[model samples]
Target: MIYIFLAVAFSVAVSVLLKVARSRGIDIVQAVATNYVVAALLAVLLLGATPEAAIEAKATWTPLVLLGVLLPAIFLVLARSVRSVGIVRTDVAQRLSLFVSLFAAFAFLGDTLTQAKALGIALALAAVLCVLWRPERGATERGGWAAPLAVLAGFGAIDICFKLVAQAGAPFASALLASFLIAMVLCWIAVLVRAATRAAPVTARSLGFGVLLGAANFANILFYVRGHQALPNSPALVFASMNVGVVVVGTLVGAFGFKERLAPVNWLGIALAIGAIGVMASS
Candidate 1:
């Protein structure tokens, strides 16, 4: 439970850091690229992850590459989402993304769709729409849904790719390290391209923020893994607690700490999102 609490805290902290990055003049691209560097190093030092397993003939490069691409790309989308829609909605959308992978499981991975899972998926869909709704149409609301929706889809695809990698017999750490390295390279490429085009300048501030982001990001993964280890017989509890905790905590932070206003429908969406996770976990 403590591990789950830490994981939820770090998860929301990532969004908070991203939320504050732009106002601080942080170069998000450079920070994101640097984040992979830090994550890859931590993977090796803390997790003892090595590339040996990733190079095996049976290891699938397709999903690994997809993860590499999606991780950083979605990260950028996530930042944009936090900037546009605020953390409450963005976090709910992200947590609800399990439905995408859930549907994929039923359609492609041969997982049975139980009644509980079906109801959870339905609730998740309704939650997404509610969370994405903007009661007041204005300049700020225009195109706001795009980033959160992308966050939802992008994370769902990333989860599917992770499943594929696991199915290929690649150990979690090795797959994570490999994907981090690839994502690092891709992000650096984008950073360099932007620098060359004068779209954004790489700065020490951005690099510093990247280090913080990476630490939080890796901590989230580490604690979640530890939570599962700590409760080996209660994975569903850890899963549900982690997801529901993030939504609840993020909402509090966004609403009180940041004073972000939310409509009643948005609150309903948050409740539905929690309910969906609970239902799925029970199933």
Candidate 2:
């Protein structure tokens, strides 16, 4: 439970940091790139000393590569969604992505879906729709569909890929190292390209924020993995707690801290999402 709490706290912190980035005039792409570098360094420094298991963990490369490519892309989409749709809706949609991973578990991983889980999925789908619903307004004023859709699919795919790596017997540390390493390389290329072509300034602020972001990001992964390890027999409990915690925490922060407005329907959706997560986890 402590691990789950830490994971949720770190996860919410990441979202809050991103939200703060917008007002502080931060270059999020560069910050994100630096974040990857920091995360990679931390992973290597922390886990690099491990012997046999770390050396043999290269077998997980396939999924690691996919994860590396997806991580930055998804982060960008999440930022865009937060900017366009506000954190309340974006966080709900993001957490609701568990529906995709759950479906994949049943379809591809040979997991049986009980009625409770099925009902949870149904309620979750409804929640997603309600949260994303926008009242009729000027076309220019409304956020479009693309960023939210990308957020949904991107997170779902990432979850499925993680499951694949775990199923392939990859040591979590090794897999984490591989992912951060590859993502760092990719981000370096991006940062360098922008520096050459766009002359994007690299500021001390970006590095500072990136380091904070990196710490929170790495902690989120580390703690979530630790939570699963601590309760190996209760994957559903860990998953539910983590996701529901994020949604609940994010909503409060979004509403109170940021003063983001949510429609009554959106509020209802959030409530339904919590219920659905509970049902799915208990199933």
Deviation (Å) of 67 in candidate 1: 0.6
Regions more than 4 Å wrong, model 2? 47-59, 136-144, 230-234
Q: Clashing residue pairs, candidate 1? A: none
lDDT, candidate 2, equals 0.83
- Taking the tens digit of each residue's C-alpha lDDT, what string does model 2 give over 164-254? 8878787667767777767888987888888788778677888788889899998998799889999999998998899899999989988
Tens-place lDDT digits, model 1, residues 1-283 = 8999999999999999999999999988899999999999999999999977975845568888889899999889999999888999899989999899999999999999899989999999999888788888642475767899999999999999989988988889999999999999999999999989999878899999999999999999999999999999999999999999999999999999889898898899898899999999999
- lDDT over C-alpha atoms for residue 178 of model 1: 93
Highest lDDT, which number? 1
- Candidate lDDT (C-alpha), each: 0.92, 0.83
Poorest 10 consecutive residues of model 1 by lDDT? Answer: 136-145
TM-scores, all candidates, are 0.96, 0.89
**Candidate 1 Cα misplacement greater than 4 A, ranges:** 138-142
